[model samples]
Target: MADNASGDTAGDALPRERKPSNTALAKQRAHIENLMQNVDKPIELPQPGSKKPLLKPPPEIVLNVRGSSAGAGSSDFHTYRELRRKEHLRIKLMEAEAAEDAIGEEFNREREALKRQDEEKTAKNRAKRQKRNKAKQSAKKSKPAEKAALPVADE
Candidate 1:
């Protein structure tokens, strides 16, 4: 039993064998080179009068200040710049107005809620005051009769 246990421990402690670093690196380099070769190869042209080729469409042309003026045959640089600046300012102004309107609507809703809460509190206080006043009036009526009887006794 001891011999079998020692052999099992030795087997468990043994290191696993791995491939050499140079061979592993060489295999990776070969795979990358194969990918590079395929990437540079041109696509075959489709035959005429058959199915159309599935090529990507050309990119859209973007017009900046120089491109726009040149395309439009206009020579004034400062006027173009001014027009672009005005368009940006107009967009910013519109965004600011929209933000202000949204904020105002939220504030109005909060204010109305607070106003309703205050009205409810005032109504409760008014009911309590009316109850106290009724109690005081009943007590006063009973006290005056007692006072009138006491004065006759004293005379």
Candidate 2:
């Protein structure tokens, strides 16, 4: 059993009644709908730019000097020095190439000497084999003579 505010007990088998007020319920529902209407939607993101925006000024050529060696040097003088350095490098490269050629000739001579030694070794081996073969043949021929000189004996 459940008790109402008046101290009267309601039957457990019976459902409790809540009086419905149409005006009040409708106003509450409208207030909720108004709150829903005021809710914020998600914001859209900005699109990517097609071209990059300029951020800083373009680079400029600036001459920096630290010591007395770097004095009022003109652009023409700089270019001339570069050309002279290149010419010197070319001369050094030619000298290096000549040295390389000389080394290559030395290697070629050594290779030829090794080839000649190999050929001589092979010829010596061939001659040794031929001599061994001749000695074997002579031994074979002497076997018949030894057999003929043996005395006959009864078994």
Candidate 3:
């Protein structure tokens, strides 16, 4: 074990610390503070404009039609029954599509109504605030004038 000037050996030196660098620690703290500040922002309720999925075709039903069970090329194929089933499915699909369209129309109408209602509410609140402010200003103006108009005391 060779020592330059002190008696301590090379192996006796303490291991270098592996703590995060100062810049990295400061960046981490800044990120945490940003997250905390963002969390404090008021949460808005999901609007009706958000996605409401329309009807979707079933996977199994779609898979069944892709096979050779409909055409008559195969000896085991059944044509009439498949035709009838396809017709029934088509009719059912039309009906469902129509119903969904109607429902979507209704939802649109309801959204318009809610929007109108909110607008009216905001207008009413603005008018109320303006009226209150005017009243307060008029009251303040009249008070000082009234005090000034009062006759001086006899003393």
Q: Which candidate is the best by TM-score?
A: 3
Per lDDT, the best of the predicted structures is: 3
Give candidate 1 regions above 4 Å deviation: 1-71, 74-81, 142-155
Can you give the lDDT of residue 141 in candidate 2? 94
RMSD per model, one decimal: 21.9, 27.8, 12.4
What's model 2's overall lDDT? Answer: 0.76
Better of 2 and 3 by lDDT: 3
In angstroms, how far off is 55's CA in candidate 1? 47
Q: What are the per-residue Cα lDDT tens digits for candidate 2 across 1-155?
A: 34566566557557779865579888899877877897885445799885523333322653543466665656757866766776676667668778889999999999999999999999999999999999999999999989999988989
- Ranked by TM-score from best down, the candidates are 3, 2, 1
The C-alpha stretches of model 3 lying farther than 4 A from their native spots are 1-77, 153-155
User: Model 3, residue 95: what's the lDDT?
Assistant: 88
> Which ranking of candidates, highest lDDT first?
3, 2, 1
lDDT of 1: 0.75
TM-score for each of the candidates = 0.40, 0.43, 0.44
- lDDT accuracy of residue 82 in candidate 1: 70
Which 10-residue window in model 3 sums to the lowest lDDT? 50-59
- Judge candidate 3 against the unseen true structure and give its global Cα lDDT, from 0 to 1: 0.77
Residue pairs of candidate 1 with colliding backbone atoms: none
Of the two candidates 2 and 3, the one with more favorable TM-score, higher being better, is: 3
